[model samples]
Target: MDEIYECPQCNQKITVPSEIDRAAQLELAELVHMGRRIDAIAVIIAKYKLGLLDSKIMMAHITAQKDTCVRCGNKLLEDGVTNCASCSALNLNWQ
Candidate 1:
C-alpha cells in the first residue's frame, strides 16, 4: 500500500510508494543484524539507481552472446576488467 501524508513545514501533500520488493528491506536488515558481510551493497544501490545493469546482463544471458559475471550476474560494463564490479566475480561465463 502507498503512504499518503502531508509535509510538516510546507504542508504539502506527499505520496510515497511502497517498496517494490516488500521483504527486501526486512531481509537486508536481518543480514545487517546477523553480522553478515554484504559485498554487493553497491550492486544493490546501482540496481536502484541504474536499472540497465540488470537488463543488459539479462539480455546478454538470453542471447547467449556475451559473458556474464558468475557472482553478480551482471555483464561487463566497465572496460579492461575481468571481474564484476558488483560482486567481484572473476569468471564471467558459466562454469
Candidate 2:
C-alpha cells in the first residue's frame, strides 16, 4: 500500500511508494554525490531486477531532484562546490 503523508509546511498530501524508503533514498543520494551514476543505476537494477532502460528510468526518478544538499535538502550554490547554508554540509556538482 502507498503511504500518504501530509507536508507540515504546505499541508499538502503526498503519496510515497513503499519500495523507496528513506534509507534507500539517502543511499542513492550519496552515490549521486560521489558521481557514481552507473553504480547507482546498477543498484536499482540489482534491487528491482529490472533491465537497463527500466533501471535508468528508475534512477532518474530517484534523482530527479538533485543539486540539493544530500544531508538537509537545501538548494545548493551553482559554483560546483559549496557548503550547504542550512546544515553546513558539503555540496558538489560533479557534472
Candidate 3:
C-alpha cells in the first residue's frame, strides 16, 4: 500500500510507495548532502516507517559512511578512479 506523507520541506502531501527497500541508500545521502534534507527524510521515513527523529538519525548514519558508490553503496577506494571499480557507478566527489 502507498502511504501519504507530508513534505517536511515544501509541506506538500506526497504519496510514497511502501515497497522502497531497493531505493538506493546513497541517493538519500546525496540528497542530504545537496541540502535536500526534507526529500531525503521523506524517503527514509517511508522506507523504514520511522518517525522524524529516527529518520534524521538514519540519514546521518548513511551520510557518515562516505566514499561509497552511489549506485551500489560499495566502499570506494582512495585510488583516482573516477568510476567505481566495483560497480562501475560514477564516483561522485561528495566532498
Best candidate, TM-score:
2
- Mind giving the per-residue lDDT tens digits that candidate 2 earns over 1-95? 64444333333343333575667667766787677889988886776455776555434433324667545677766543345667654443333
Residues 63-93, candidate 3: write the lDDT tens digits. 3246775456777775322355675544323
| Model 1 lDDT per residue over 1-95, tens place | 74444323233333322452445443433433344424224433444442444323322222122345534466656432244556554331221
Taken over the whole model, the C-alpha lDDT of each candidate is 0.36, 0.55, 0.53
Q: Which window of ten consecutive residues has the lowest lDDT sum in model 2? A: 6-15
The alpha-carbon lDDT assigned to residue 58 of candidate 2 equals 39
Q: How does candidate 1 fare on TM-score?
A: 0.24
lDDT of 2 at 39: 97
Model 2 misplacement above 4 A: 1-17, 64-95
Order the candidates by lDDT, highest first — what do you get?
2, 3, 1
Residue 41, model 1, lDDT: 40
Candidate 1 CA-lDDT value = 0.36
Question: Model 3: runs farther than 4 Å from truth?
Answer: 1-23, 68-95
